[model samples]
Target chain A: MQLHYGFDELKDIDFMAFIPIILPFFAVGILLVLIALIDLYRHRKTRKSLLMWTFIILFVNTLGPILYFVIGRKDSERL
Target chain B: MNKFIVLIKKEFVQMVRDFKVIWLPIVFIFLGITQPIVTHYLPSILGALGGGQGITIDPSMTAQKGGEVLASTLGSQFDQLGLMILAISMMGIIQTDKANGMLAFILTRPVTVISYIAGKIVSNYLIAAFSVAIGYFASYLYVNYLFTDVPFSHMITALVFYLVWVLFIVSFTTMISTIFNSQGIIALISIVFLIGCRIIVGLSTVIDFVNSASMSKHAMEVLITGSVNSKAIDNALVTLVWIVLILFVTNYWIANKKFNHE
Candidate 1:
């Protein structure tokens, strides 16, 4: 049984076809980045190395926001 | 019981405030989809990049069972990166409260130590389980779409076995967080130990019988072969025992006020 068609079919796959499939992936990523940015903006005064975190959150894709949340958010706010 | 509910409520509120409610499942969903998508595309990706010069890629080799792909989603993606993310996100579960004197403050409110520990474990376990389940389901959908369809019974059985391991992870991380002070150390220990258990799963039968990571293996086996290992229940019971021991240590640590190191 041909479990999958060969590379010829794969090569013929439309780039436009992938847009819908991959859109959710991008949406989740962008949502994470946006939430991290908004949180960072709100807590800008409490966090140290504000410029660095802002750069990380904007540039590092998905991991950057998670890093911000896990490490950066706990700077000096706990009282 | 009342205090336990209040504490669980407090934990969820804190999760919402921290954006954990938003990000954790999203991260899991991302990780879940990545395995099947990447596997499905890798041959074409290699063919496109390799210039058709030397090695021709075989499509038959790339053809994989849906169960095998789903199993890899747990073994490859969830075990390594997912474990690390869970550990990091939970590293401060108890450590933060201890550091900020919140543990002590909460204790002073006539709350027994058991309820406090129970609250932490129950709330965090629910979140962890929820995140993992969402991710696993995401992987299941993509696996069925891209590969052969796995049987529904096998999927649920594998998930149940895998969740036993996840329960151990939650309780173990909670214990480490309670006993340790630094988030870095807690994260490091939990990640190393959990990943180590996963790495050593098939080393020996004796070890497999006692290892919680074997539950992951059992899950993968169920997915791939559609047969549950007879020892799966035994391994699960052992894992539950480990969780109970971990929680006992956590309770003992807090009850003894051992966290008041100055």
Candidate 2:
């Protein structure tokens, strides 16, 4: 099996070459954060801990949004 | 059949309204790409983070097979964080319906108990399977670009096997949701048991035959070695049987109204 190594020397590696590879990862994360922030903003009246959720979603990265969606969003006043 | 279709449509509508359709796959996609990128860049990341200190990383030491990288995507990323996400997302599959009296209300309709149970499993399973597939495919792309090329046959076959294990996860969580009233308990039990099964996969052969998690190991083996295990077929069958058993328990619990914990 032929293995393609990214670089022979660490210093020789160009960070720009990696931008394409890493871009999707950041894009997905930012999209999630954006969606979460939007949802949290729209439901601010019903959602608990409004300020805290905004901070969590903005700063906590990927997991922050997920946590807010799963636990923070109450969905209904009756429940 | 029409009723089942309606139930499925209703589930899809609910998913869309709840934004589950949007986020679940994205989460899996994030997880899928994370493994390959992290593995490829760990050396540089560590080197840059540390003060050029004690442990220097060798690029040659980081050399890995595309198949190995893909397998770890399933073994490490998908199995741990992926599993938790799935369990958490699905923890309320039936519990929410039960909580809102929707299950009982729906049963009063012309729907059979079988159709009701089937609808829940089918819809949720599709989402779970789709998320995992997208994630696995993302990992495959990165693996091919970053490492050696895994054979087309190996990649496809490994995914088929891995998805069977995912089926078990969905059904098992559904069963727990059906029997338990609290989301926390359901999530806790599903995560613990599923992760436990994954953790004990290679301890013994006797356990391997009945353990649904063996399918995951079989998948990883196919990826790394480019050959299916002799026992993979039998293990898959056992896992299917386990899924059926879980579905049966879920159906039984719902039909008998055993979920009324209040």
Candidate 3:
């Protein structure tokens, strides 16, 4: 009942093994950018702020896209 | 009752007008369809890139076998679904209201605090439930079409258990949203809580009885194996308690405090 991808197996990986691991992260990053762009177009006044968030999302990696979607986007909305 | 209905209608109207309803279902459906496909295809997709390194890619090994695919798919979806649906939905609702100074106006209406809170919670729950249901159905259809020899009964049971789990998560997110006025803080707290719960439950294996009470632990177990035991019941009860506690606190906040737009 070893229910996880063994850490031992993952640790013994090479460059080839890294691609799949990074794909989801990259996809998520792309998704964040799309969302930011869409929101920017909708709210023209906040285009600069939205672009700033898009950069943050691209640079932040693992949790960055999620943070952008949840918190960062909310920051640009007119309150 | 009329006021409550009116409040619910108001919430639904705002949700539709803002297009929050559309994005939620789209996200859930995307996660549902892609998680399994991505997980199933990742290794083979990587191998096809023709790296110079001698990486022997066995297609048989790459595709999940022996029923593990379902488990991994369900488990990953459960973990991700909370952040995607629950936290994101809460942030959309609460932050939009706070940002537009709509909270003050809504509060000034004839609607009672309880009614307003109830409307918010009920509508959010419905949206979450609908999204999860669509995702579950999509996953089921995809799996049935792509593979055979799946234990259909077990999959059905797992789907039912997962729906219950989603309810618990939605309720928990609603409570967290009520406690925090800022969307950033709410999202931060929700992510922290999810990670913390997983770690604590993972630690329970060495600690014996301690893991038995963890909600995420029970949820993962039920979701993967399609089995429900007393511990899962206990976890459900704990989640219910949290929902009630949060509602009480939210009602108190609304009654005693006035919101000022910053």
Candidate 4:
């Protein structure tokens, strides 16, 4: 099987033009995933499903890190 | 008043340590920027796919303005995803304290139930507000560059008016958090209620008057009309009443709930 759109078709795409637009999204997504990883590693005891959360945050793109932020970290009972 | 400041400070410190200080705004900024860039590129993306699949493209689908782009930042992004994040993030505000024995400890002090709950709500709401502002402003800057300069005053007005809706969201989630023991229940109810408001409000004017989600539509209207609509004010007043009612109920719930004291 071949890729649906070949490199010849990709020639239509202006890499230089698209790079500025795509870069911000990539930077934000990667940064957020890294932060998610750091938080997961730090809170392994309090947090549930270290492996699951790591993968979710790492693989799921924009919404993944958000899901991690919203639901991942275990809230401590003690103040 | 002193106690409120102290409590607010404590809550703020916790927020910083939780990394909420960093994640919340950055995520929103990403979302704010993402919606426009994606929507703008959608035509080209589809065009590329269309050629591969032998399909035609619609010109109208790609056509949009700076105002609409700015509006969708709220209409689509903040209204849907942002609302969910707000609900889930604040889901355990009081429940966590109750679960961990902190609620009981705090109560034994001179702090009123009102003050304690107020402190939690205020601090979280401040973060939500800051996050939204940064995200909204960043998106607006991109919109100005990519599309055209939207009316500066009108955009500011729309945001300020839209913020009433945000206030309701933050308070509503905090109240739901206060009432529920399970974070699962809290997240579920808050999301369902907010989403329900969006669905039902547009169906009837009576519902619209009370629906905080309408504020987003009204906010968009301000940009399109180039002036704040009176209805946005009316909706803000009604939502303020709702916010007060939610907080009141939350205060009552907190006062009565049984906590584990260790």
Best by lDDT: 1
lDDT by residue for model 3 (B1-262), tens: 7888887888789667545565555456555656556665555455444343335556454554424455545567746654554666575555466558776688888768888778877887787778766765555554444443356666665555555556555656666665577776776786677555545655654442332225444544554455655665655665567667778876776677534524
lDDT order, best first, reads 1, 2, 4, 3
| Model 4 DockQ vs. reference | 0.36
Interface RMSD of 4: 4.7
Instruction: Provide DockQ values for all models, in the order shown.
Output: 0.38, 0.35, 0.10, 0.36
Model 1 alpha-carbon drift over 4 Å, by segment: A1-11, B58-61
Residues A1-79, model 3: lDDT tens digits: 2223333444455657556545543464466456644654576565446666656756765345445544554545664
**lDDT at position B80, candidate 1:** 88
**Clashes by residue pair, model 3:** A79-B99
* TM-score for the B chain of model 1: 0.97
Clashing pairs in 4: A77-B100
Candidate 2's TM-score reads: 0.93
Model 4, stretches more than 4 Å misplaced?
A1-13, A75-79, B52-56, B256-262
* Candidate 1 structure quality by residue, lDDT tens digits, B162-192: 9999999999999999999988999999999
lDDT of each residue in B1-262, candidate 4, tens digit only: 8888999999989888889999999888887898778777776676566666634445444566788888888888988888888888888888888777787888889989888988988898899988988889878987887776899998898888878888888898888776677989999999999988866757888889888888888888886667777777889888889999998898887787634333
Fraction of the native A-B contacts that model 4 recovers: 0.43
Q: Which residue pairs clash in candidate 2?
A: none
State in Å the error of residue B52, model 3. 8.2
